[model samples]
Target chain A: MLNIKDLKVSIEGKSILKGINLEVKPGEVHAIMGPNGSGKSTLSSVIAGREEYEVEDGSINFNNEDLLSLDPEERAHRGIFLSFQYPIEIPGVSVTNFIKTAINESRKAQGLDAMPASKMLKKMREKMRLLEMDQNFLSRSLNEGFSGGEKKRNEIFQMAMLEPKLAILDETDSGLDIDALRIVANGVNKLRTPENATIVITHYQRLLDYIVPDFVHVLYNGKIVKSGGKDLALELEDKGYDWVKKEADNLV
Target chain B: MEDLKEKLLSSFIAFESTLNGQAKSPIHKVRTKAIEVFEEKGFPTKRNEEWKYTNLKPILKHDYKLLSHPESEIEFKDVKRYFLHDTDTYKIVFVDGVFSSWMSRTTHDGYDICTFASAIEKYTHIVNKYFNKAASQEDSLTALNTAFAREGAFINVPDNTIVEKPIEVVFFSTNSDTEMMTMPRNLVVVGKNSQAQIIERHQSLHGNNVLTNVVTEIFAEESSHVSYYKVQNDEYTASLIDNTYVDQKEKSNCTVDTFSLGGKFTRNNLNFNLTGEHCECHLDGITIIEDDQLVDHHTRIDHKVPNCQSNELYKGIYDDKAKGVFNGMVMVHPDAQKTNAFQQNNNILLTDTASIDTKPQLEIYADDVKCSHGCTVGQLDDDALFYMRSRGIAEKEAKAMLMYAFSNDALKNVRIASLRSKLNLVFAKKLGVDLDFGL
Candidate 1:
């Protein structure tokens, strides 16, 4: 369902992702594990088409269409979703209104009419209940004065609402407590389907205990150094990044 | 044309003599001082600091004839009809700047209301104490109004009497004869522990080039509450200069809101004095100008006593080649410690040619006071615009929606429901935004 070939990206003339190649099929959960500054976020941003990163060389193909040729919102309309590391707070706009606008815009891009308010409200309530959010969260301003865990949960709630084909979670567990992590993992696990794919990017294997990735890749120095089954995440967690660095250096 | 200024000056002199001829006491003294000030200052030109951005060249170039008391009486049918609940409440009407006794109503009990001309003779003591006390001839135009103050409205509320009904005064400028200038003065007094609301509306009927210079002074006594609303919807060729001065006593509350949507050149002066501790004052304004109109609002709130609170917010939306000016000042006296004062002026320039000059001033001499003043002039946020556009709303509708949202905070602060609805209608007609969008 997704193919990336030697994707080299740079921001402000500094190359962040160098010659990285990855592939994933439907019904598969791919976990990218690396230490800080390992180009883990660069890969996700490059796929999501954030304008800040300059694609030095490479091509990204999603279902046989050039992903890099589209705008941010265009990619968003094409079912490319990236859960932000830090969600921006939009004041004076309620979360329900924001989500409705997004859904309508995406649907319009596909030549659909605006969704009815009644059905949208019902769907929103069901999703909010799934994430254990209060009724006030739906009416309050979008992400304004929201706690860190609440913002993450709201992101997952948005993901459920949009139901994108490919989902990328970047550093979603960084600021979350253990309870928040479990709840977020449960949300991600519940949304998995055979027709969609998930890419979980993290630094530790703690999240792997719940989401259980099918493929685990260790990324270091702007390139994916090794790819293995789910046991690779546990081995890296026990031996630390230096052992992996030595092993990759020997392989090179 | 050469003798027009001389003719206006003599007309004002004749008016002064007639006013003093009727009652020659404290009011005569005040009017004489105002005339002297007018003679000294004359009319302000573009050289003045306050009048620099707003030029009166058009007014000065025209040969405006003085409008005397007309022989044809002003009829009640000329005024806009309002099905108010209180039928016994009085009404004072001004036609071509002259007070008309036949066009007004009266309550049997003098405690309720009466006309200014009739009440002047009966309640001279009450009128003498507050007449011209708050707003005087500080400027040339103000002095000119004072010189021609032949007729005005004087309202007095008895101590501890709650005036449940609103006193409505209609000031109509008739230009059926020729280009005219009308000046109407008003004094409203709220007695101790009394409550009242007043609506003074200014309109021009059958007037092509009419000018209305109105001065209203409000005295809110201790523990009293006063709410005043000024609605200016005149002809395109009409101009207005309305000034309101409010004085708040201990524990009293005063709110003054001015809605300026229709006028060629509109200038308003609002001054509030918090003379007693624990008194609160609020000044809110919204001005929407189009087609090269010039709207200027100058407000000053003086915190004269300790522990007083004052809030002022004035917002303007200027489109086409229109220009807007807001000069607001919050002054804290030296002895007024622990005073809380806030002032903000924000403007949205829809077109590149549209201009705004907003100045929010804070003069603090007192220690241990909380005072803040800020002014912002900019176009809409680009990110916000993109966000709204991405929602499938067209660019024009999204712009209008954002502009309406920008003004929502200011209009929602209006406490009166009827007034809020009226103002919303005016805004909706201009911006094409439905009034029930967010409510």
Candidate 2:
């Protein structure tokens, strides 16, 4: 579903991601775990086509199309969604209207009419139920004065609504409590389908216990140094990243 | 002397000839003194402190054909859309420079809702008392308008009368061969314990290059409430210089909201004199200009008595090569104790070429008073842009949404629902958004 070849990224002439390659097929889930400043978020942002990240030398192919050549909105139209680490608080724009505009805009890009209001409302209610969000939450401004958990949950709610082909949850479990984490993980697990894929980017192994990943990769520095199954997450949690950091330092 | 200024002097002689030797009349004496002031001041240059950021030379160069009478034969159907047809309103409409009685819906049940021309002749005593009472004789532009202030809206509400329906005054200029000029002078007197709301607009139909130099004087009597909405939108070829003077009495409250949605070169000189104790005055404005358009707002609030309060908030969004200027001044006299005055001006420049000059000039003589002002200029947030773009919304639409949010606060105090919705449509259209956000 997604392919990256020799992905080298930098920002403001400072190299962040060195040569790296990854691939994900449909019907699979991949979890990228790393410590702070390990370029985990950068990878997700680069895949989402953030303009600030200069793709020094890389090619990100999504569903046989060159994603690097497309704008962020164009990539979004092609089912590439990046759940932000910190959501923006846009005042005066209700969440319902924001979602409606996003959905209609994506549909418009694909040459389709807007979804009827009734259908949109039904879909929204169903999605809200999946996330256990209240009905009034749809009318509030997007992320304005919202709790951290609510912001992350709202991200998942949008992901469910858009039903993106490749969903990258960048640090979605950071500011959530145990109960909120369970709910968020449950929401993500419910949205998982054989036709779509998920990449859970986190700093800990706690979230993996709820939405178990099919593959686990440890990203140290810029490149993925180790790859294993679900058990690898427990191994990293048991022993800290110091040993991994030593190994990566020696290798560099 | 400049050519236009020199031409105006000669034009004054021709204008006076039309008056049929009413030179000894008190209003005519006021006009004669105003013309002398216009001659003395000529036209404000960039050197003048108040007119620093605005350059009137380009507009002053035009040999304008001052329209004394409305010659355009306009039907009700042609201009019905301009009125607030959905809402119950008392309309005092003017076509060119003449009162369109056929298109207006005024009343004589209690209030003298009529034309300025008729009021000057019929209610000469009342006109003589209030005419040019609040407007500054020192302002060359206001003086120029006073010299030919024979037309426009004239509204007088007696004491203790509540004006139930909103009054809408619309001025439309039709397509003329030459670049025409229309000077509308409006007088609104809200009596003691009375309340009134007004919406004034200047529009041009299928024409370019019309200048409307308007002067409006409002008197809010003791314990009265007045809400005025100046909805200024016109073609890029149409320019406007609006001079509005407002005087508030004891315990009176007045609010003026100016929406400068579209125009070529616009200047708003809004002055409020808080003459009595415990008076409240509010000045809210929203200016969104694009292309090479320029809009300047020079507002002043004078707290002359004790216990007066004033607030001003002006928001502007400039795109392309558009320019804006906001010079808000608040003056508190020595005896005006406990005066609470606040002014805030926020702007967002959408392009590299777009710019604004904003300053808050406060002159306070009273030591025991609260006066604060703030101004901000910035572009759209980068993180906000990325967030919206990643949600499948394009960059342009995202910017428009941010602008709408920035300008939403300035529209919060619009009391008229239909007029507010109409402004919402105009605001959305200008920002190129597709939502009827009634904020």
Candidate 3:
């Protein structure tokens, strides 16, 4: 459902992603595991069309459409969702209102009528229930004074509500306890379908045990150096990234 | 330079003759003294520190005819939109500085909500004691208003009487073809243990050059509670200089909210004096201006006695070369121990040409006092904008939503329900959005 060929990205004249290639098909879950500063988050941001990163030479095609030419909101309307690691706090905007605006804007972009308020509220309640959130949580300001676990769960709740075609969970497992991890992973697993795809970006292999990715790729120094099945994550966790670094260094 | 002042001095005789018995009363003596003060100070120039950011030389240059009578007739159906129609209120309406008895609904049941001219004769003792007592006589504009103050609202809530209906003091200037000026003075006294709410507005019917210099003095007696709301939404040709002074006695609570939505130039000098122990005062203002508009808010709160608290919040949004100024001062006297005062002034400049100057001053002489002040001047948060945009909201809608959220903090404290809803609609219209969210 997503394709990236020779992706070269830089920020402020400093190169971050250099000549990377990745492809994901429908009905498959991909996990990109790497150490710190490995451009895992940058890749997710580039795919979601963040403006800060300058893509010097790259081509990102989502559903056979040129994604780089679209704005962030346009890409979002095309079912591209990026769950941020540090959710921003928007004071005075209730979560329900914000989500409704987002949903209506996306629908308008596609020349569709806005969803009925009753249906939206019902769907929001159903999604919040799946994430084990209180009904009052929807009335509070978006992510303002929310706990880390609550923020992560709220991200998953948004993903469920939007039903994005390609969901990139960038470091979603960070700052989450075991119980939150289980709940988030369970929520993601429940939403998986044959036509949708998921890319789980993480530094550790703990999140993969619950979500259980079909493919695991080790990203070192901006490029994916090795690709294998779910066992590769366990291998990286047990033996550490030193072997991957040495192997990448030898290949260079 | 002396043309407007000389004209005002020459017109005083005609203005004085209008007051039947009040010409020889003690209030006239105060007026005579006030005119002398105005003659001495003249119009404040830019050299004055307080008037540095604001230049009144242009507004004072106009050859404005002081309006003493209604020049044109206005049907109540034509101007009824200005009033809060949904709420029950005691309305004191004025047209061209003259009271419109047909348009006003005064009260005589237990409390006095009538015109200043009648109140001066009917409740002579109350009018003589509280009139012009709390306002500053040193300022030239205030002194100017006092010299010309004749017809306005006078509200008196007796001791221990809770006023059920809020009072609406509306001044409508219908000088369609001529440049005119009006001064409206209001005196409100809430007796001990009484409570009252008031809404004041200045509206011009046509886009003519109309200047309104208003002065309102509110005295909250011991343990009384008062809330006053000022809505200044006039045409581009209208300018207003509002001087409001409030005095709170022991255990009293008072709040004044100033909303400057539309005006060519507006200056508000709001002062609150906490005279006794355990008193609370709140001053809140929200200003939204665009296209060469200017709104300046200068507030001072004096914690004169112990165990008093004061809070001030002012927010401004300037767009397209508009200018805004906020100067807030809080003073805790030597014996005013355990005083808690907080002041915050925040502004957002939507364009490169828009500007805001904010200064928050705190002078604490007491040993034990909690006084904190915060001020910020900047554009909207880029990260917050991006966060909203990435959630599928368009860029313009996202920016408007963020601006609405930024101003919501000040709008939440609006005490009157109908006025609050009206303000919400005003804000939505300013932001160019159809906001249906519950406030």
Q: lDDT per residue, candidate 2, B1-439, as tens digits?
A: 3386677777778888878856678999999999999999878999999988989889877767774566567777877777786899998988778787878898878998999988988889889999999999899999998987788899999999999999999998875666778889999999999999999999888565888899999999999999999988888988999999999999999999999988899999999999999999999999999999999999999999999999999999999999999999999999999999999999999899999999988999999999999999999899999999999999888888888888877888888889887888888888988783222
Error of 2 at A247 (Å): 1.6
Better candidate number, 2 or 3, judged by DockQ: 3
DockQ-best of 1 and 3: 3
Clashing pairs in 1: none
TM-score of each: 0.80, 0.94, 0.98
Model 3 Cα lDDT, one tens digit per residue, B196-291: 999999999988898888999999999999999999888999999999999999999999999898989999999999998999988888898999
Note the DockQ of each predicted structure: 0.14, 0.53, 0.70
lDDT of 2 by residue, A93-199 (tens): 88998899899889999999998888999999999998899999999999999999999999999999998999999999999999999999999999988999999
lDDT of 3 at B52: 89
Docking class of 1: incorrect
How much DockQ does model 1 earn? 0.14
CA shift of A97, model 3, Å: 0.2
Candidate 2's error at B329, in angstroms?
A: 1.4
Best model number under TM-score: 3
Which segments of candidate 3 are over 4 A away from where they belong?
Answer: B437-439
lDDT, candidate 2, equals: 0.90
